[model samples]
Target: MAAKQYKAIGEEAWKNNVEKVNAELFIFTYGSLVVQLVKDFEDYGAVNKQLDKMGYNIGVRLIDDILARTGIDKCADFHTTAEVVAKVGFRVFLNIAPAIANWSADAKEFSLILEDNPLNDFCELPPKAVQEGLWYSNVLCGVIRGALEMMQMQTEVWFVHDVLRGDDVSEIRVKLVKILDEEVPVGDE
Candidate 1:
């Protein structure tokens, strides 16, 4: 099955990579950063947008690392790309593989169902944050958007469900806007 292959590949890639960090420390640091953002902005929407922007920046850099580590060549289609993102990408980086589901009729959109979200581990939104409709994992949406963009795939990513907000399942929706044509540099052209 694809899942088994993905797991094996992910595990191998993870082991080969020497650099590592403690999960607890990483999660806690991210949590602290989120709290600070909330305090500074005092508006949940603004904070969410800021977090997305930050994640977008991170994603742009991360895709290069991912390509180098995974050695996966350009994906031929969105379906293959989705599999790579869900199976290899998330598994390698987060140690959790979200399920790809809810493909649209045209296959231009899909949902990622995260059964386990590390960012939410030991995270509980304060009453104010919840009241203000803060999405604790907004950064994830941004990351996906940014990473896809670098791959010449324009997409809109957003969280549709959050367990922190009392949703039964955490889900992120990704809609493909368009695939960009590869551009040659001035001299290369």
Candidate 2:
């Protein structure tokens, strides 16, 4: 399907099918979750890892929701995969379709430029956390990684820039490692 068609599907689903929630409640809840993670781990890096793991679990299930909600077929190429993810997946989930940009010459990597991240809404990392390399939205990288893994696209996703980290825009870099045609169970392999 074309990117525009995906966008239309996302818009329609978000408008009519999905249940609405209080945006502030969601944001505050996420903020408190981060706070609790930081306190529990006492290490910014560990907090980030925990957030990523949580998001990965969410994404593993989220892909199923996207497939059921939009009924789009698997993307045939990396370019189309990028488009469908930007136009459909993010939109249906966050109501914000980040801009896809900075494609590599090989087209194996690209950046998702989030002009506005709901997660970063009203979030500011402290100086110590910033110095310790806390990616305020690291969860998103895990989400993308897990979601694409389900799509048979092995990818490395991470935050290259974060608005909460004082960058002009939040950027998530996604690099396609390889496409998996088949897999072995770990012990069998």
Candidate 3:
């Protein structure tokens, strides 16, 4: 139903409606999801949690769009999948401002610098503190992370730029830093 409408519009049309669609999408989500999901929301905690949850929700739904756009129903390997995500998925679908960097060979993680993040204007924070806010709309990170995980690539996504501190025209950075496995210590020090 709704998915059909979205698909019918095509990516070209969607890009054209970036401003209008994004604005309307914000309004629709604000009115429906934010207001309805969070009860008695007053502080940053409630807002932040809600936004992250909202991103999770959107991530679930966005899987459909990702499939439609990429025609990738499945991945043969994580490396191939991450390449697809970095090259096609993020670049084409979301129209991210900054160029992304892929440092992971195993395809377990990747990173990017996001310029002119869309969610920063609605909320502001220092570059170091951007992820600390409750009202921050970081659902896109969660969306990509969750969506890719389901697609068989366990990944973590996050932002590096905080656009609220007059950091407008800044880069939106996401990292896929590797997780070091804990090694067993030798018997004697």
Candidate 4:
């Protein structure tokens, strides 16, 4: 249940348990999806929204996989949640665990700093897309949001710095809105 434990579990899972994939193929597939979304929507904002929605759906299911793989209990707190997300969640899936930083005094917010993003590999945005406020990797934000929602933690995630947007590093800012309580079914309650 500790961060260190999660790190070791992530290493074990990534090395031995998880099925491998061709990074290039995965990247190309994702790239193609983004391109198709752009073509379909013809609007950068809409493309971002679609991508986020797709990611959210993925996240909702992905959490189940993570839980099954790790067999871990609910996160003790947001800080621990951040650690698990950085060390285990990202590592198992992306093979990258971003550095957690810029914590607010309230401890309700933090930033995940990625010096290198596999998603951005060989990806360069067009000037028009940049000008139109398109977040090429907006799916990641939705992923975090959806994953946390399933964990009963409502968090807002957004990209504050993106290498695609010419920032030095890709940073995702996560703010805890509140913890969602378990809900009873209409008839059961």
Candidate 5:
């Protein structure tokens, strides 16, 4: 189910709404939403799950917008999907300066290790960060899993490293997992 739509506005119109744009800003503010929304909703335990689902919902919608923007056809396989992610998705959709060469393909999936993570490097999380639990990039992870699922591929999002600590560099890894099993349509009248 979709979230409540507040004041429908077009993409072009959105640019003028500074507060709304800042309200949905993801790069430097992913955690803030999770923290605030959890308390606002009064549900902390389900935060991660909600984040994942929300991310997937974003992917489902943004993938179509992205494909339309780049004029690229749907990728047919995992490799092609990964290529699209690096060349088109990352570059156009996220406006990321991806070197594109450092990305690697593994047995189960491809990994894009950004030499500079804009989200993490954009701002420093306070030492002894007060928020409870892990500060994972739930939005990005959700987008990837959601977009891939739209392309009919199953995926899992996991965090391999965090730069919150004094690690010289942080690493974030995502791997494509298995296809979801088909379920019979059950009816409740």
Candidate 6:
């Protein structure tokens, strides 16, 4: 019942806020960016880190857009937050709804299973990049980390599986480290 409501909200919000783009163009742009990153860093780890940083920055700003579009209030728990992220956040931004799975016993961690990734559309890692252990979608992890940070949830987000690397399912594992307390600056007080 709750899932259905969230889906409806996501669909309506996406319809109202999202700007439709050609999937091919989006794929081409992302591919070019990856190519440039590879050329600049040479090391796959460094490239992935840079991409994650880029996504983090984007996520920070994206949260504002999401809040404005969805008009969703503060979530009462991490579980609710995760549902919003999976249903509304990704759906509105990427037109894909990922499944939240693999919950921890304490509910402090879970996995997001991405069945369809826009960034992975028409994407194939070059043999050299694969050999160097590059994570092609590292940015997604960073985005989740940054967005959660802004929401006052300290979290570690990382990719655990990638279909591009021959995994049957692409998954991101997010661990809630702690909840951040809102602090007022001394000067402001």
Q: Top TM-score: which candidate number?
A: 4
TM-score of each: 0.93, 0.94, 0.57, 0.95, 0.65, 0.94
In the range 1-189, model 5's lDDT, one tens digit per residue, is 011111122222234422323423665476567557566655433665677778889988977876565455656556666666655555544545333233444546555655566556455645434244444455667788888787767888654555655555555455667765555568832
- Those runs of model 4 whose alpha carbons end farther than 4 Å from true positions after fitting are 186-189
Better of 1 and 6 by TM-score: 6
Q: RMSD to the native, candidate 1?
A: 1.7
Which 10 residues in a row give candidate 4 its minimum summed lDDT? 1-10
lDDT digits (tens) for residues 1-189 of candidate 6: 276777888899889778888879988998899899988998999998998999899888888888888788877898888898899888987888999999999999999999988889888877787777888989888888888888999899888888888889899999999999988889997
Provide backbone clash counts, one per model.
0, 0, 9, 0, 0, 0
Enumerate residue pairs that collide in model 5: none
What TM-score number comes out for model 3? Answer: 0.57
* CA RMSD of each candidate after superposition: 1.7, 2.4, 10.4, 1.4, 8.8, 1.5
Q: Order the candidates by TM-score, highest first — what do you get?
A: 4, 6, 2, 1, 5, 3
**What are the Cα lDDT values of the candidates?**
0.88, 0.90, 0.52, 0.90, 0.57, 0.88
Expressed as tens digits, the lDDT of each residue in 32-81 for candidate 3 is 55444434575556665656666667766776666775455565545455
Residues 1-189, candidate 4, lDDT per residue (tens digit)?
666888998888789778989999998889999999999999999998888888888889888998899887898899999998898889989998899999999999999999978999979999999999888888988888899999999888888989999999999999999999988779996
What is candidate 5's TM-score against the reference?
0.65
Poorest stretch of ten by lDDT in candidate 3: 1-10
Q: List the residue pairs that clash in candidate 6.
A: none
Clashing pairs in 3: 48-134, 110-176, 113-172, 114-171, 114-172, 114-173, 115-171, 115-172, 124-164
Across 111-177, the per-residue lDDT of candidate 2 in tens digits comes to 9999999998888889999999999888888899899999999999999998898899999999999
Q: Give the residue spans of candidate 1 off by over 4 A.
A: 1-4, 185-189
